[model samples]
Target chain A: MSTRGQLLLLWTTPVAGVLFLAAYLMFPGFSPPMSPTMTPEEVAAFLQANLTATRGVVIFVNLIGASLVPFFACIAVQMLRVGNSSPVFAYSYIICVGIGLTAFILADYCWGVAAYRPDRDPQLVSLLNDMAWFFFIAPAGLVVVQNLCLAGSIYLDARPKPVFPRWVAHFNVATAVLMIPGAFAILHKAGPLAWDGSLSFSLRLATFAVYVAVMFFVLLRVVQQPVESEGVLL
Target chain B: MAITTADAEPLPDTNGNTTAPGLVPGEASMWFFILGDLLIFGVYFVCYMVYRGEHAGLFLQSQRHLDQGIGMSNTVVLLTSSLFVALGTEAARAGKAARATRLVGIAFACGAVFPILKLVEWLPKLGAGITPGENLFFMFYYLMTGLHLVHVLLGLVILGFVLRSLRSASTPNMKFIETGGIYWHMVDLLWLLLFALFYLIR
Candidate 1:
């Protein structure tokens, strides 16, 4: 692909990130997240009270899966240049992103369904809400794998001029480590490890936001350099 | 590029005597990882303190349940392991490959005791039905220490690689060795803070 084309794809990262963040603020129960300890009636009541905003989020949520594709494509393009051998890391990264995107879409769909008929049985509404949150927060393994694959590729890049800097690899590893606490969300219904808690939700969200911005700048720098050497094609 | 034993060069001395002054010990990237890891953990520490202040009685009572004897023993074990790793790094820099390998081997043995002790400390409490869901204190204890255990496990893997490098390569990769050592030390440092926060803060 042309460098201009790649640059355009790379630009999608920030565009999607900012748009998502802006859309996120438009909703109430989502940004702060509903408490996991809420009773079924409270959960149903929450959706009914904020039906319009919850419904509005579904539109952005549907677009999220597709909007981030170009950004992930850009990441794979960079990964393809790292190792001399077959581009397994880039392949694995693409696969992980695919699964990760599905997870996010699934979570949103659960929310969409929950918001669809808030007048329904409270228990059922709560069930969908719980599933949505679990899907949203607990599938952090996918992101962790993506980061590890990218970091591994960067570390194995023995080129005199590596694709990404070494510190980026370390940063990726750090991000992965931070994401691990999300796994604990399932084990806690309250406190900092719950789905709505500080460690699980706030920390993961912030880390991902920072990670995207950092990678966007790094990709911008890479795309600026003329594509001269051949390593692997995406 | 594949490195052969014959082509391996002597390792660089990390000791101040041979190296220039004001040099950081390991790959700059590894130091970045160390600092970033510590910053992430620092967030948890601050949050823990806040929660403790809010629920001082609960936290203090939970703190008593922790086995201080085992905690103290693990501390000594890790400290001793770290000392050997330091000496091993120095030996490797001095090009004493066999001696360096032996010292690191001892360090690995000491590091191995940590997880065993952890299991010993955890199983009884767990069997008694004390889990993360018991309370906020237990949740932080399990989550933070569990995260630290993962770090410890990864450190052992890195140490294993360092041992392989020292044994197999004629000229070891000093940067790799130093990086591993730095990570091991960070793990040690984290445990000290955890010990203070969870076991002795009352």
Candidate 2:
């Protein structure tokens, strides 16, 4: 194998394993602790009452997640490569993901613990909450990160030798701009900008949906012939 | 087969910043795509994190149920696969075509094993009657790690391609290996996280 190939493999292998392990180990009921409001006895009763279908959606999600991760990742890797701005954006994307992953996982375990042990220290509980707040739940910083990547992709594609199309560029910009409110909407609370982040979460997400649909359409259009190798798409 | 865009003459020295000039256009574009993907993953992650925040005890209480041994074994599988990928790249660069082919084959094999082992690990659990929405923690667990599994399958497919290319005397290109390797590294990194998330926390 070439050194470049070696380097690529080094980065990807662990991620692949994690993907696999995550699928299996992080199953439904692996981290059970749902009824924060009810006492343990009451919680058991509640679970007994609503036993059949409660975790069904989550299992459905697992089936879906098991499928989507690889497919999306491939597209993502290829899309970034469709043009040539790897050096500028690679580390940022990975690091940000690294941060997000850490946050997600930490919050995951902490949530499990807190759920199981209701009598745990309030401070510890709060600290865990804070961790999730900073790391997992809020979509604010990440929304920008996505846009930045999209913008970078467009900016690169907008190059003289354009590997992608001009419409794709326009589409990326529109998506980036439209996604701004989503970050705040994710929290469903008064963020720094206030005002309920402009109403419903669905609306915020809907704006992004437009971006996703358009971007995918544009990507399909651009991929028909990605011939220009010499220049950045931007 | 015939002269394509690559056969086009190298442009005159224009940009002076060709430091690691080996980085190909294909490689660079992949990075861009990966970065974008990260954002999507980040959003999902953010969702997981936010919910986790409100219910820390609920989350960790269940985290202790994890089986650390299997998690660690998967990590080993990933790390070993990475090493094989690296060695495979080296073999190709050295022009030892057969060596390169074998190493890539091993890497691919390693990749395959991880997912299979994953299945082996999960089968019993599904049978055990545990489920997501069993609690708040389970929800995120299924969401985060489930996403990761999909990536693993994809990696396995890609690795299979790399190995096939090797047999054809196409001898995996340095750029392909590097790109794939970097991606492999990302998979490995995610596992360390799983360990921390599921096992370490408890």
Candidate 3:
């Protein structure tokens, strides 16, 4: 593949990230996430109040996973250069991306169902909303495993000139560790472990954003260098 | 990868005492991990303190339920384990692979006691229906300690690798041994902070 083409794929990550955040902000109750403790009637009312914008956000949110595919593929492209004799890590990276993207797609559809009929029973709508947020935040394990695979591949790269810097591997592990608090979101309704809480929501989001930025910049360096003799397999 | 002379060479300090030249005592990459891990945990500590300040009474009440005895016991266990690791690293440096292997084996044995004690501390409370959902304090307690436990478990695995290298390699990877020691010590240090915050703080 042309380096120019790979760079284009790399750019999709930030584009998708920014668009997702924009869609999130377009929805009224999501910036400060809707509290898990919010009553069913309150959740239903909030959805009813912003019904049209909610649908718009849902549509954009659903498209995010598709837009992010190119970026993930690009990551795997770089993983191909990690010098492991077997291409298992690159394959593992793609598998993880599929799982992670499926989670977001499922989460988006939950929101869509919640807004499908604003006049639906408040309890059901609230349940779907709960499902949406749970699907959104609680699947930190997916990202954790994904990054660990990437980090492991980089760490095991025997080449003196590794595709990704050694510190990036450490950074990836640290990012994975930070995401773990989100796994416990299922156990709390309030405080820092809830879907709406600081450690689970804010910290994870920040870490993820920073992770994307770091990966983007590093991948940029990868694509800019003259194509090595060991070309990308894909 | 073999240890480089730059990492193995001894140098004199300002006081003229010769010391190992690897000032950071491991791969620089491992130090990066240690610092990043510390920063992440530091954030959690700050968050815990803020929440504790908001609900001092509830936190105080919840904290009293924690078993100080087990907490202190685990602290001693980890400290002893860390001491062995330090001695093990020194022995590895002095070219005593067999002795180093023994010391690290002892460290692993001591480190293994930590999870057992954690289960002992946790099982009764869980049986009594206390869980992360009981209150914010318990939530932080379980979450932080659980995270720390993972570190301990991972440290044990690293120590295992260190032992394997010591036993099998013709020239032991001193840098690898030192890196494992650094990680084990960090695990020990985090547990001490956890013990103080969860058990001793009033």
Candidate 4:
């Protein structure tokens, strides 16, 4: 692929994140997540009312979010170019990002299924809603692992001048560690640990979005450099 | 490229002793991880305090279930381990390779006691039907401590690598040793906060 094509592919990483956020906004996900305390009937009513919007937005979410595969693949390719070390870190990053992106797409499908037949049993609808939210947030640790892989690769780069700066590697590792607390969302219903709570959902999403943006710019700069001078400057 | 050569070469002191100067011990990247890790923990701590304030009664009641004795002893163990690690890092810096290895080995042994004591404290409480599911306080306690336990386990692995590097290399990789030391100290610092929040807090 041409260098421009490759850089465009990498840009998909942040674009996908933004698309997901837009989809979330369309579906009112920014409000406190659907509480477990809601009765089946209440959940069913909510789904029935938002059926069209939820289905349309999730379909778009699934399509755009799949772009993450190519995005992360580009990252793996760049990582390989910067170092002669084992390809393990780069490969693991691609694998984890692949799995994480798949989970995200599947989560949208789960939501789609919930909105498909609102006339169905309310309890089943509630169950599917629960499934969608849990599946969306729980696998966050995989993304964490993916970040760690990238960070490790950057840190181990033997080039006299590494493609990514040392601080970026540190940022990636820190972001990975920050993502862990979100897993506790499964254990709570109303508190900050809840799926919609500030720590689990808000802060996590904010950090992830910021991370994607930062990395997108960093990688963009790296790609813009001449092929021969790739690692010569940050 | 300029910085790389400078980093690779040790500087000579006036006394003719050569050492890397003004270099943050460990991989510079590790300090980033350490600072960010602490910030993450800080957020959790703030959340804990907010919840504790909101549900002071339940938090206090749950705090009673924690065994202060075990918690205190674990604190001592981790602090002592951290001391040994600090001493070991100094030894490595001084080029006493064998001594650094032995001191870090001792640190590793001390760190190994932590999980055992954690299990001792947890098993009885778990057997008594107290779990993260019991209430909010227990949930926070388990989640935070569980995450710290993961860090401790990882620290042990890092320490193993540090020991291996010390033993295998004629001159130990100061960066690797310092990185491990910083990580272990972060682990120690985290436990101290956890001890205060979970065990001694009102």
Candidate 5:
């Protein structure tokens, strides 16, 4: 297998395995946040009221997740580089990914997951918690693994023997770095848009503004075919 | 010598010449592409599970409202249709164009039955005003199954075109056959996932 084939296989295999045994694995570290029910105005009022170390950490971790998307975007070309898919397949690939793109554009994970209240109906909350657990097993796992694999694949491909072009490697590196801020943003949300404390409103908007800007650049790149060498697609 | 082509295979437009080392095409990455799609939808699937687990009661409540038989029937329809496409691929590869075309026609008909069945399944939900983004159940139902349905429709369209092409074209290339087969398999694969995720989520 080519390096990427191996990388993708490795990248994808764990996700598949985990989803298969999803019910078995215990999701560690990333606990669900409180489920608050504050209104938008209340959320704005709360953001103005607090700044602390723990709050910063939450924002930072969430930032890491939300910002990780560009790396996924970087993979778009590299994955395509690995082979010539049928036009329909290619079209579907992009469309399916386009759906995934909603996460970044909406930034709901940080805004909703992190900022919500913990004290809702015990029954309903427990149900939401279980559902969240299910999510961590597959979609969340794949997102992390896929991003890491794309980064690794790009790096490995950058090595002289790799089939992908050098630019993809550089793109991967840049993408990994670029993804951090948005990830932090995603990690900072609440079930209630009103209550969770993460970043200043200005920073949130600025973070999202930067995210949207970067996302546009990445989206443009994903749509354009990368320039390739004799045996490599950049 | 004037290249009066009684033997030159028509460029996939019509079938005339048959004296050949079969104008076969190369391998396709359709499987790879489908795997890629699986990965993409795989995320959504996980998301559904996560959310479902968190809100199991709601989802189960919503699921209870669905007709399991309808979902199961659609699954059977797609699987059998997929088999027909495979048969078509085999016959086409063997240079039995007529048999391949017939199989493709059957496959197309099978593929056609799906959205019809889905339409029937969806009517009750539509009447109930259930839709994606409304709640966890509708969200996964429409997002996952709706997206799958779109792919099915697209597959049927492709299958129809290929069937038509098969009937009209005299000479067929194995490459086209292979690629078309790959496309059909993707359609089939998506349905399998839909069946697993949409119907069996409970």
Candidate 6:
């Protein structure tokens, strides 16, 4: 791809972020997240009240959020450029993140399914909602591995000029570490570790948005550089 | 201090300081890490305080369950290790490679005790069924401390590399040593706040 074309692909990273935020804003009643402590009746009523809107917004989330896959794939390719002859780190990052994003898309669809039929049993709707949120936020390790692979590759680049700056590697490592708390969401009902709690869901989401923004800029700089004979830009 | 060759030697220019050029130790990238890490931890700390304020009673009750003895001892261990790391960085800058190696080795040894002490602190809690799932306070305790533990482990790895670079290279890689030193110090500084917040604060 031409530099301009590659740069445009990177812009999809932030577009995904914006779309997720939009989806979040579309939540019914702006309900303070469906805590596990919330009763099934409450969840069922929520679904019944906003069934159509929920389905539509979730579909948007699934389609638009999936943009992250292509964005990260672009990152993996950039990593490959600077990763010397061995593509282990870059490819591992790509595969793990690919699976993780796929999980997210699947989880969003589960929410859509829950909203599809307002006549379903309240308990079943609640179950589906729980499953969707849990699946969306609970797989912290997938993110950790993806970030670790990217960070490790940057640290190991050994090029005269690294593909990404060393600080970017440290940032990824820190961000990866920050994400571990999200896994604990499974253990709580209403507290900060709950599936939709601040530390687990909100903080992780915020950090991820910030990370995507930073990497977009960093990758922009990389792609704009002249491509070398072997396709390494830096 | 007496004027010696060590004092007269020009410091390695790492941070772009001209007057006392090379005074700022470590790769500039490390500063970025330090600042960003501090900001991230700051956010976590703020969240912790807010939650603790919301459930003051639960937090206080859970705070009593924490073993202050182990917490204090761990603080001491890390502080002492950080001391050694700082001294090692100075020694490396002064061109005392052997001394720097020895000090960092000590730092690594002290740093190594942290995870073991954490296990010592954690096993009994787990045995007593006080896992992170116990309550919000314990959850923060484990989550915050657990994250710090990961940093400690990574710092130990960096220290090992520092030791290797110090010993193997004809001249010590000052940038590598300083980077590791600053990072280890950051680990220590973070624990201080964690200790105050989780263990000592009333």
CA lDDT of each prediction against the hidden true structure: 0.88, 0.56, 0.86, 0.83, 0.54, 0.84
Residue-by-residue lDDT tens digits, candidate 2, B116-149: 7777666776667656757777766766677778
Question: Residues B95-174, candidate 5, lDDT per residue (tens digit)?
Answer: 78899999988888888898899899888788887776568778678777878888888787877777776777787756
iRMSD of all candidate structures: 12.9, 10.2, 14.7, 9.1, 19.0, 23.1
TM-score of each: 0.53, 0.41, 0.52, 0.51, 0.41, 0.51
Please write out the lDDT profile of model 5 over residues A67-164, one tens digit for every residue.
43443444454454443322232234344445544433233233334235433444443444333323332232223334444445545442344434
Specify the poorest-scoring 10-residue window by lDDT in model 1 chain B.
B1-10
lDDT of 1 by residue, A2-109 (tens): 477778788878779878897679766766788999999999998998999988888776876568788878888778778546678999999998888888888889
DockQ of candidate 3 compared with the true complex: 0.01
Q: Write the per-residue lDDT of candidate 1 for residues B107-134, one digit (tens) a residue.
A: 9999999999999999999999999999
CA deviation > 4 Å runs, candidate 6:
A29-31, A232-234, B1-202
The worst-scoring run of ten residues by lDDT in candidate 6 chain A lies at A225-234
Question: Per-residue lDDT of A74-136 in model 6, one digit per residue for the tens?
Answer: 788788767565778887887788778777877787788888886789888888888887778
- Candidate 5 local Cα displacement, residue A57, angstroms: 57
* Native contacts conserved, per model: 0.00, 0.00, 0.00, 0.00, 0.00, 0.00
Q: Could you tell me the lDDT of residue B76 within candidate 2?
A: 83
Candidate 3: list runs displaced more than 4 Å: B1-202
Q: After superposition, how far is residue B69 of candidate 6 from its true place, in Å?
A: 84
Off by over 4 Å in 4: A13-18, A228-234, B1-202
DockQ of the candidate models in sequence:
0.01, 0.02, 0.01, 0.02, 0.02, 0.01
| Worst lDDT 10-window in candidate 2 chain B | B1-10
Q: For model 3, how does the per-residue alpha-carbon lDDT over B89-151 read when each residue is reduced to its tens digit?
A: 999999999999999999999999999999998999999999999999999999999999999
Q: Report the first chain's TM-score for all candidates.
A: 0.95, 0.51, 0.94, 0.90, 0.33, 0.92
Q: lDDT (0-100) at residue B91 of candidate 6?
A: 92
- CAPRI grade, predicted model 6: incorrect
